[model samples]
Target: MLTNVPGYPRIGSGRELKKANEAYWAGTASLEKLQLTARQLRRQNWEAMQQAGIDLIPSNDFSYYDQVLDMCLMTGTIPARFKPLLERLASPQSLELYFAMARGYQKNGLDITAMEMTKWFDTNYHYLVPEFDTTQQYRLLSHKCVEEFREAKSLGIHTKPVIIGPLTFLLLGKIKDHSLHLHSLLEQLLPVYLQLLTALQEAGATWIQIDEPYLAMDLNPAIHQLYINTYNRIHQAIPGLQLLIATYFDALGDNLATALQLPVQALHIDLVRAPQQLTTVLQQLPAGMQLSLGVVDGRNIWKNDYQLSLALINEAVQAIGQDRVWISSACSLLHTPYDLDLEQDEQVLTREIKHWMAFAKQKLHEIADLAQIATGNNTSLAANMAAMQAKQHSPLIHKPAVKARVAALDESHATRKSPFHVRQESQEVAFQLPLFPTTTIGSFPQTAEIRQLRAQLKKGTISSEEYHQRIKAAIAETVKWQESLHLDVLVHGEFERNDMVEYFGEQLEGFVFTQNGWVQSYGSRCVKPPIIYGDVQRTHPMTVAWSSYAQSLTKKPMKGMLTGPVTILQWSFVRNDQPRADTTFQIALAIRDEVSDLEKAGIRVIQVDEPAVREGLPLRRANWDAYLQWAVQAFRIAVCSVLDDTQIHTHMCYAEFNDIIDSIAAMDADVITIETSRSQMELLEAFARFKYPNEIGPGVYDIHSPRVPTVEEMSSLLQKASTLLPARNIWVNPDCGLKTRNWPETEQSLRNMVAAAVQSRSAVLVN
Candidate 1:
């Protein structure tokens, strides 16, 4: 049996790629210099995987931005808006155009909006969603995949080139014209894949791994047939080339039968998510076809149980001979950190938790070891099993106080003091605001000056008093701006914070901050997830001082922004010693303390963001109920401490609320704002159908892009939202925070947003 991984993290160990890309964007580094840095990182990643004894090392997975964006670049799927940037380019092929597509560009009086980005199938990672039109044409714009394959081949690694499957590419994309279908362009799309495959075959590649993760979702028969036809055509076109159709993130379910019918050489299924499918798969898989068994956990930081994984691999091998079974990771290592050894401080990570944990590097080694054990080479298996057993029984993991507190929890703790109607009346009386209140989703820009000041403070170059003065000044300035814009709700701009979760993690006990443990959240967006160890609790107020200070500056209500418990737990490198729910509840209690403290300090409108809650949903359907139950309870326990008049609010972004709208309502927040600007409020149909009984700020403009929305555009979205639900239930805000944006775009966007709110007031007041 051979060990294989579909992909690995493209961001370098110390975030070399992030630094390089930033320097290039800043005009400090040349394109050649940035390309050199990327080349070095990619070489290091391939070599690391190679050294781990991986037989089917993957190429073309590494991208400066996102893989989907790379595909867009390769297939010449450039939209018409980017034509100006391309025309002005000095070189025939400039990465500036690529970067423009990923992040919108504004230079020399030209402006272009970025394509929409959303959650990559229930993970924290985000991808650029493709946009297609009938007039969209495809060409071999770049030979990147073929070039990478040759590069790896020169380095003595005949790697399997990985590409996003055509079916998945079309499935994730939306049609530019509402009257057209994205799948209609599939005929044109298949040629690009076919040409790429022929090129890879010529580049000395024996096999190719086509990632089609969408197959795991609940696909309709038409979509399933599309998958079959797409693969069948490719298989027919490239008869000599071996193709492995890989699926991950969940079970194949009904798609299993369809997948088995494909004429590919092999099919990879995530045995880690749906282990029960192994028996059916082995029995039903046609003879002579290969089965790549994904047994290692690629999503979590926890170490694999070598014995259990080996047994599963053995079962597949027993059914379909060892020659036909390939052991691999359940999904890409894109979701995990690079290495555990980088976490040098044992006092923080601890030996106990460290023993139970595994990063990407360690995970690769686990896959190799599992392959060894499955192949009847148990040289080090017994020792690893003994160590695992000993760590499971470690006393350090079992915190008696934490367990007792969790067990003592009852329904009262997770419920609001009053119903939604009562809270709504009290909130209206407290604020006396007009319909369609205009507000931001917390945080203004985290400018370079702010980032530099923060770095100085961290390095002890600035005093605590000096930092506090700067933060207060920033908040005062933000309040002045909001007042100038005539916004109903204000925020402090979060100048005192570096990241939403890391700021709170620094104040709370049992959480350790990292200096360079950055993991890629999306394109050029790397987040250093705080390490949560031991039982969590609050020793002092986290956001009370900032929120209270901001409120003092404005007559308009300043929303107390805090990251929710579920979000904190989801965004952090959590402790694997106990159940995630236990860790989550502990985080909730800590947030509860902060919420109560904020309320006492005269902070009325609290906005706790749980953007990661939906992303944290388990991949499997059977496992979702248990996770959501605890996750919802955790969110409630954090904000339920306040009285009805306090007007508790929560914000969620990059989430699909349709499946969990009931749980969202269950949180009992007086107001809930979600990301809808990218989808143009398409996400709210579920809320409309369910009659979601709370105030909602379905975002009127997409903040993630640089192109500012016009007043008419924002007004049009709010008008559409008004048609869905009671107009009073609607609020106006940007899709997400403005931290990543510049001052110019943010100012224009908010001005337009306020105009849209004013225009929508009549609709809101009609009933």
Candidate 2:
């Protein structure tokens, strides 16, 4: 019984990659230093897998930024805007070029916007969306897959090179040229995959793991045929080399029969998310295909169930031989934290709750332990069962009061006092303002001094009162600056907080923080997701003091910022013991308390951000309605507590909202701000088509890229948005938060954005 996994966490336990990448980007560290750090991290990851008894270690799964972006550079899917840099910059500066593509180029007298970015499938991790044109061509652009495979082999490790499958790569990317459909690039992308596969074969690779997560998605007959033809082509081209097609994050569903027809040696399915699909897969499984049973939960942190996994492995072995049955994590451990042992502080995740959890390192050991237990070794089963039993019976987990409160809640709790039209009128009276009101998406740039203040408070070097004063001073500076910018609908800049979700989770009950449990959200951006071990409750007002204080600073309407219920639930390592919807409802109740508190404190406007709600939509369309029902209910529960006169705003980013426009409308927020600049108001088209009644702030400036747009550029985007939806229904804003940006770029971008808005306003007045 061999233990296999599709991928492991690439970010180190301490986030060494993040620090090094930031240093290199800041020019404080050399390129050699960054490359060395990357190599060291890769070696450590490979060694960790080897030590954990992983039979099929994965290489090329580690990425400097994102694996999809790597695939983009590999397949010559480079955007045309980088042609000059590509031609001018020599080979040694390839890493620089890659970083330029990931983060847009702002220096060297060039201002190129980075490619569009969005949620990768249904996770917090973002990937750069590859842009394709009508004249797209594919070739062996980056030999990173081969280079990495050989790099690992140099250290005496036999590894399986992992690459995103061609079809999935094509499916995930967007077509920049309207003349091109994504599927039309199949022929163009195939030869490059063949070339790469051939190179891997020549480099002493026996097996290649081609990740086709697209298999788990909804597909029509045409797409199914695409899969059949694709695998057949690969099979004919490289007969000697074995290929493992890994699918995860969902069940194969109706595509199971079609999946069996593919010419791959082995196939992996996500048994964690969709265990019921195993019976169907076993029934339709081809004669010679190896089955990888993904029993260990990869997307979560909960310890694996030994008995359940052993039984599934036994059942599979009974159907096929033991040699053909393998155990692995359900999906990439990229979604989870790197290590759990780092949570040494007993004040955080206590020992009792820690026993029932597993990070990436623990998950690897769980995979190995499962294989060992299935093969007549029962050493670890007793401990696993003890932890499971403790969790089931623990007073820390179950709360009758919380459960009763949820049960007592009725439909009235999830409904606003009035509809949007009525609320809009009340809000207009509440906060009198001009058209195209300008505001940021809550946070301003988190500067070094502000971070130092928080660090000092944590370390006990600064008194609580001193820290409070410093935060107030930072807020004062921010408020004064926004006033100078002549912006409307101000925020406190969220200077006292950390990550949007983590800060709220810290003040709430039933959620545990981690000292070093970092997971990569994107390049150089890591988040430590709190663990939801028990029933949630709000202990105190999370942001009322800050919002009230900021509102006192200015006569203008100050928006109260909060991480909405769905986003909190989606971002956290939620408890597996109860239904996710139950936990979300608990969180909603908690946020509802805070919303009421803020409104009571004279906060006229509130912004509850549900950036993760769209990402939380079920992968299969069949399951979406139920999820959306609960998701929308949770959001409504959070904001509906406020009066109709209190203008409630919600912000969502990155994910496409076209399909879920009804649900978006169902959230019943008075205003919705979305990330649209990367798409050049393309997302606004959906809202326009849907005739979304509420006010929308189609972000005219791309905040993700550091390149500050010219006033003209932003006005152009505003004009584009106005043409789609009524100009009266539009607000002016940036795409997302400024937490990751610097003060210089953030100031310049906001200044340009304000100029654009004012320019738009002047034009409208003239009309």
Candidate 3:
């Protein structure tokens, strides 16, 4: 059997791409330097895969921004809005034009907000949403996949070029013309895919990995049939070209039969997520069709259980000969960190915990080793087996106190004191703000100076007291600025916090920090998700002091910000020994402790950000109910400790909550703030149709981009939102936190937002 990886991390070990991209954006580096950095990273990635004995290395997966955006460029899916920007640019083929589409462009009197970005599947990674129209044409705008394949060939590596499959691409996109449906463009779309495939065939590429992860989800019969037709047509068109249909993240239950019937050379199924599917796959797989058993967990940070994975792979090899079976990761390694050896926290993460962990590079080695073992060479398996055996008996993994606490949890621990309406009335009396209360989604900007101070604190160049003083000063300035804007609710500007989840993880017992484990969240914005190792417990108050201090400095209501249990669990590379729900519940209880402490310290308004909640929903609808039950319960467990008058607010960003409206209401947050600005109030339509009982803060400013919305634009969005729900039920805010943005844009955008809210409220009163 051959060893393969679906995809690899594009960000360099030290986030070299991030630094180079930022330098280019800031005019500190030449475009040539930026291109050289990208080329270097790509070459390094190819070389690493080749050296790891990967027979099927993937090319064209190294995206500067996102694969979805790359597909948009490749297929000429540019929206009409970006036409003016392209026309203004001297060179239309400039990467700046492409970057402008991913991130908004604002310079030299040209201002354009970027296209909307949403979470990719159930991960923290965000993708630029593809916008389509009736008149949209399809052509090979960028031969990125073909070019990358040639580059790899030049390095003596014959790699399989990866492309986002047609059906999945179409499903993720939206139609601009309300008169036409998204599927209607498939006739024009399919031809472009054929052209690209034919080009790859001409370029001497033998195998192409077409990722159709949507097949893993519960699909209607028609959509399942659509996949049969789509792949069949492509198969007939390119007779000699081999197509490998790749599906992961969940099991293909009903779609399994449809997938097997497709005319593809090979099929890849994730055994890590759905091991039960292995027996069925072995039974239904057609004669002479190759099977790629994805036995390694790609989305996790844990060491693969060599005994179990090898057993599964050996079963497949027994059914289909070893020549026809390939070994690969369950998903792309894009979800993991670089290398475990690169980790810095020896004292905290520890040798024992590190022994059981494997980052992306280590995972590649495991895949290689598994291939070797399956081929009857067990040299690498000996140490892996020993480590796995030792971990099973480790005392660090089994703690009585954490188990006792989890067993002690009851129904009462997950219930609030009152219903939302009663809580709303009391909260109204306690705060007494305007019809449209204006607030931020927490986190004012993290400036260069703030980052420098944090680095100083970490390096011991500055004392802890000095760090605290600087953070306090930053918070004071943010408070004064918000008050000047006449905002209703205020935040302390999370200057001391590095990340929303990482900050809380640092205060918790079971979590550990990394020095250089950054993963790309979106564009140049990278996040280092904390590693959750052992049983979680909170010993002391996490956010009380800073929240209490901020409230004391302000007359307006101050919101104590905390990352929710679900978001914390979803964002972090959590321990895989127990059920995910159990780990999530543990994290919830810890946050509950923090919530009670903050309420006791006089924080009347609290916002627990659960932006990852929707993103964490199971890919299969059949599995969503079970996942949501515990996920919602976890959120309730975290916030139920606070009184109704405390006004629990939960914030979600870059999510499509239409299908999960009932689930969102189930969380029972007094006022739920959603990310709607990028959608231009399109997301609010769900709540509008549902007539959602809870109050909402529908974001009016798109904080994801550098472009600041004009007062009129913000007012128009508020006007539209008011028409959807009662004006009194709607609050005004930005789409998400201001951490990724600069201070100037954050301030200007908030100023415009507040003014719009004031104007809209006045108009509502007039009506």
Candidate 4:
């Protein structure tokens, strides 16, 4: 009888939050105005959920930036580096701390940088990494949970507040000082969690969902014991509050049996992913414990089969009685798009294929409907059943041509025209460059003027001709800057793109753009993921004009930037009715056309960035090879369309490549760049172990931080990299693109990068 929706979308239905935040950051909008906009959006969300008949609506799920960062601020887990800035500003509220943690702060004397952010559990969503040192302490900042609960109550809506579990928080955090193990910090961190839970309890929150998704991972014995100990203490301390320990994305596996015995009120299992675990789970369910069955897929856009879902709910009911069963989503809907109702294009097949569809709003309705049917509130589920049946039988779900092409895909599509050795010989004769050539990872800083111009173009305030001219001018200036620095392999600055993926999606058929379908990719960063609604094909060239124009401006080999096929599929709200391999192959075919066109346009270096390639991997390692097979084939299909002498390059961002080193080599890119500065070239060991033969550019400096790298620092990093990699196989670059950095840091960092490459070349000669 406990119907609930997982986390709600935070980007705002109309993307009002993204616009307001950007405007405030750019000084175009006032702080008061941004605050008012977020408050209004929150109210609208609460009202909408209330009208939808959601039994246990969630609060504190709405984040101005990131919920994990919000948790850090709420528990007073501020790093010492940020404390002085908070003191200098003379504003020490939770909101101030949260924003400072997200955007960072620099006044006259005090300089504080934000914590390092990385992807959240293989999803595009990012969480701020909490910092811990020897003197780490805990205190409740502003009672955020209590405040949000009170705010919702005043609006006549009682809500269950959500908070990140202490175990998961520590699992995601970093120990900078290295004085304490993770378990040591938990003792100090747990008191604050206890305090916050007590406050929420006092504030009349009957239930709280403690998100410990780390339980789903392969945990060590010590960590497993720690989870047991931590929950025992919390359940004993906070006896009044009903605790729902939610584990998602995959089954809890060995942890499931132990987790079921924990002293919690309810156990939320992801039936959509691990439906087989249901029978085993039901057998082990304690007499009084409730079951929150996550029948709706939270991470994807697939519509639930109402008939199938009802049968599963009935099974749970028969196994554990109707009173003990509830319906929910497999994970948080924060990963999903905002509302499907806003997408107005009838040509977008996904919109019309509503049976294979459910956004956050629709999922809530599904939960409520499932709950009603279980409670005997409705007799006939025929209408919803028929709707689902029609969707499964739709022509849109299957395309014979697409299916045939994928089936006929051979090893030749996954292989280059020639082997790496042959390609390398040809590329060396063609490029004729230095031993340690330097280049950037495509984009430069996306300035406010450029953003405004894009916004204006989108709003029809600027003509396409005028916009094209402006972008060309920007690219010219950027090329000039790179030439002045005397760097090799110049990029066109990616001035024409709003995002790497969105740019290609605009030119590709079977993809639909959304004006307001924004989803948070990281702290204060939102991406409007294009929806792949049908069989994809490239209508025309996507990046040829900009690459051609930049090449015309400079004699240096300009790199043609394209988002790889796997990344395009990963980042977009892809069609779920078909296997992802089919979608990726379709995208690969489209990008293949662009690659051939760019090569013909005289762009010798093309960097196809597959940053999200690792994100698409299945959580379980057993299922990795099948995913990697198609993923590598997609990359090969895209890049093999180019000539051997064209010097095909691929870039990966913030991924551990140890397991996939062979697959990466299998892709056969002429050159590969990976993010390595953060891990201190530890990631490059994979290349060394695999004896990876292709050229590599292990990033010489971390681009995420604002701190300018000295030439010595970058030189040292390059030296360390040379020890792990063959000097002949090395190139020099930053960890990722420079879009997130300011002009000052971007220029300084690239200068140091070039200097380091020079230093590296000299050192190799002397050795």
Candidate 5:
């Protein structure tokens, strides 16, 4: 029996990667030390799996940043812009290319910026996007897969190496020059992959897992043929290396027929996501080809019912025989928390409930155990089955009030007090601002002192009164600064909040915080998500105090910031017992109360940020409408309680809003701000094509980097935006919140922003 998982968590259990990476970036740690720590982590991860009896362990899953970026570095497909910096660093071809692509270099005649990065597949994780041009060349920069496989072998473990397939890699990349199609780059990139596969075979790797998740997306007919030809070519070139082409996040769409025809050893499908794909997949299987059934959930923290998963696995075994069937997770465990074992000191009920659950480690064990059962290893199977049986019958799984409420849901709960056009007119009359008004996405810089004070308060080193006073002072200072800059709208700076989601989670019911729970969102960015336990409700207003106080200090409109219901649920550890839609609605009702409270407190403008809403869209288009229906309803329920005269705004970051343009318009926020500076405001083309009616603040500058945009640059971006969007419907702002930047850079960026807006207004009138 083969026992393996697609991928495991790379961010260490206690966020060791986050701390180590940040220290290295801040120049507090040496490269050699960081490398050693990463080595140790790899060893520790491997040993943990080996000890738990997992075979076919995956290597090269560890990445300093993202796996896709690492694949680009390994394949020698570095964009030409980073070449000068790579030459100057005198660094190894791999390390120099990788770091340069992740963080740009501006020294030694190298003034190139990093490629654009965005969220990866509905998770908080981000990946560096590969930039392709007509003249782009491909070669092998480093043997990362072979080296990692050898590293594991040196530690007395044989491993299967993994790589993102060429199709998905190209699909994820952008063609900067626009003349070149991604499909054309495939032939150039294929030889490098073949070379890597041959090296892995020489290094004693018998099985390789190539991820081609884009195959599950709606593909062009030409691309579908390309998948067949690409795999057939590779299989013919290297017949000895067994390849397992894996697809997840959705079922194989029109590509299923082509996927089955590919010359590969086995097929892995995500049963947890698309359970209906099982029968069709079994019927389509060719003789002698193995089936790696992905039955356990990988993206969520839910306790799996082994009995249910066992039934599915048993059916696969019945169809394909025990030897031909294996077990694994539906997708990578990189999206989940590390070990639930570390969360022992949490609430007793939650902790006890967690024992029924499985993290990466436990999931691996489950896969092994299920494989053993399939092979008639019955000694431990009975106990495991009984444990799962007990949990399914537990009282915690069902609550009458929650069930009744969800069943009786009405359409009225999902609608606003007034229609959008009426609300727009009323809001315009009440606020009365000029065309192309200036504002900021909520949050100013969260300084070291603020972070320290928050930590001190958590540790009981400071009183609540002291913390509140310090936060209030910070808010006042921020308002004064915005007034001095002559900005049109102001924000409270979100000084008291640790994160956009965690802050609201702290104030709501059915949620619990983790002391050491950390998951990597990007390179050095980590978030500790709150776990939702039971019925969700709001006991009190979350942001009213800080927002009302900030309004008291500012003559300008102070936008009250709240994380929207969909984002709060998406980013948190949600309950497994109830349907997610029910939990989302409960959260929506709770946020509705807060919105009403904010309006009652004289807060005229409120911003409900739904950054994760796009990420929560279902992977398959067939299932999209149902998910979007509930998600949009949840947002409307939360914000619709406020009066029409109250200007309700929503902010979304790092999303491709083209497909969801109708939904974005349906959201019906009076004003919406989105992250567009990274793409040169190209995302606004969607709004232009749709002729979107609402006000938009297409960001004038990118906030993810430390580079303070020049006034001329910001002015140029605003002028481009004005061409697509009506000047009256446009607003000027940064791409995102300033929590990651230092105060000095934040101040300089805002100054440039205000100056650019003033310049744009004058230029528009003259034209």
Candidate 6:
């Protein structure tokens, strides 16, 4: 009746902490080989959740770049522009002032920038937001969850420690003085989380898991009385600290009697995302309270249906009986993928779909066999009920012409045969581009010899005519280096893709793939996704032969990138037996037949992208209009079958498009390339208070900040995005992909972003 695990998978199953934090940010590794690969990936993720017996094993969820920026450098919550790199990186801490506040400090000449990242609630896993102000204070800087709980109690492993809750760290921070009273910063951050949970209950932690995922969001009534005065002032300052709070992805609806008036002993809940709030948190169980039950699916790879987690662990062990019921993980397997048995023998799914599948070390053995079949020890529920009846009669999961083209789509297959001012006067008379046009957001710097010729053409030792004659000579040397950075809408440089949704989930049909499943997606990035599992279709023209061979080596308007069917169904590992808007309208009619075969292969500027469509919204604005009306009709059924002089674009990353700027201008997408340089153009104040009529490339340089942005800092963020939009609906790029940057900072940041779109088209012809 025990087994918890609100976190694990600190990126190692061959990411080795993304190659030791990019070889210690390229000084070729050290700081004792990146703290010996973060102490051997936190001792192989605490020896694989203590050999999967896991009784609440958590310990600071290891991070080099975000456990909410390690609780904003352990509650000192710096952000006054990283307090002068945390007072020249010393007694305000260092690891280069925590990677110059998570990447943005121009070596020694001290240039700063980086604090603001989003999506960690609606997880595609990015965090670093915490800015706080109204004279922000709070103290206990970094005991790093009590030195990773005495480094897992000197490896004898008595773990638990997890931390983040001073009301979800001031409700995932960034108050920046909106007269900053998140209840006076959670009562000035609850005595620095009661001196960091009384130093993890004097370093032998009985149970500390604090993480209050904002009690599964959508709270009010003063954030449910600031989670009842921050857990009744840490249960009256450590009244024998047990804590465990944790809610996850969703539901705790009407905040379940303010989460059973929190005098926290244990709560957990997310029975694979709101299993009808487990009959109201086991009928409000509080006497000697303890429930846990998250019942496994920590953001999907799918598999543990040990008869639906032993019927919700035998109804929370018959209403909190078996020693107050436990069985965890519906939240942090850090959004899954560390080991589907390290995806051995190059798994492409079918060995009966790899026994239905399960990563994060088989979800810590499905939360220790749903706590040994709710304590009866029913032998791992007979091979997870024969891989859940062989994945429900799998004839490799149905198609019938991809369910009759997502049941013959409607809304005229998602509109667009010309609008946004008639596709901006037919894309300005078909590409006679100039005023402020510069492009990118399709990859460019995936080097290391293009990931070793896409790993020697997937190890057939590089043949398919020597990997397309070395990917058509790296797409004719990146279309002559984006025409020597004069860049006016050009981009073949996907460099024979690997992941922008696993290169269109490897040519689409019911997708499989996994040679070490990857995952991370932020700092030192990771990806590898592609799991979708059955009934998405278009098995050809997946990027019209390298975008019609980079549009016959470019005459400028080349683009054609593609990842969008709601970012290939919000970055894959999907198929939970249908209706994620019917697998995003069968991956938007297979990216609308690869955007009408990339406009019949003459490819006139495609793009697509959908950077995880605001990481699939719905963290409850009463479920964001049924998930933004089928994610703006699956990005208008994947670029509405082209030709309003075919332009189409779409990019979006750090998505806070001010509460979905009318579902991102109803995703009509005639050019949207967002992510305003880490909020410098401040996400162009939501396309300038929604006067947003398409075309807004607003990224003037922050390809995830390695810091080479300066042609007067990309012409002062394209002159603060032309005083917030319509200097002819602006377009200058770079806030997203330069595939995790490096070709001398992607050629001096697109030559300081095409000299800041030619100095914002000479300040728009000097006003």
Q: Clashes in each model (backbone N, CA, C under 3 Å)?
A: 0, 0, 0, 2, 0, 0
| lDDT tens readout by residue for model 1, 225-333 | 8878887888788889899989997888888899999888989899777888889888899988999988888877778888888888888887889999888999998
For model 3, how does the per-residue alpha-carbon lDDT over 1-767 read when each residue is reduced to its tens digit? 78889999998998999999889988999999999999999999988888888999999989888999999989989887778887787865568888999888888778888999998998899999999986667788888899999998998989999999998998898888888764567878899999999999999999999999998987888788788888889888988989899999888888899999999999999999899999899988999899888988888888999999989988888887898899999989998888888876786467777888888898889999999888889898889889888877887666678778888988899899888888889998999999899998888788899999999998899999989988998889889988998999999989989999999999998887777778889888899989887789899998899999999998899999999999999999988778989899889989999899999999999999999989999898878899899999999999998887898999998989999999899999998998888888999999988889999999888887778889999999999988899876899888888888887777788889989988998898798
Candidate 6 lDDT over residue span 115-194, tens digit each: 87888878788888888875546698878789888987888989888877777877776686667677777777778879
* Cα lDDT over the full model 5: 0.83
- Once fitted onto the true fold, the runs of candidate 1 whose alpha carbons sit more than 4 angstroms away are 80-94, 107-110, 178-183, 461-463, 576-579, 618-627, 723-727, 755-767
Q: lDDT of candidate 1 vs native?
A: 0.85
Residue pairs whose backbone atoms clash in candidate 2: none
Which residue runs does candidate 2 get wrong by more than 4 Å? none
> Against the hidden true structure, what lDDT does model 3 obtain?
0.89
Query: TM-score for each prediction?
Result: 0.92, 0.99, 0.98, 0.91, 0.96, 0.36
Between candidates 1 and 2, the one scoring higher on lDDT is: 2
Lowest-lDDT window of 10 residues in candidate 2?
84-93
Which lDDT value does model 2 have at 570? 89
By lDDT, who's the top model here? 2
* Candidate number with the higher TM-score (2 or 6): 2
Computed on alpha carbons, the lDDT of every model, listed in order, comes to 0.85, 0.90, 0.89, 0.82, 0.83, 0.81
Stretches off by above 4 angstroms in model 3 are 89-92
Clashing pairs in 4: 303-356, 303-357
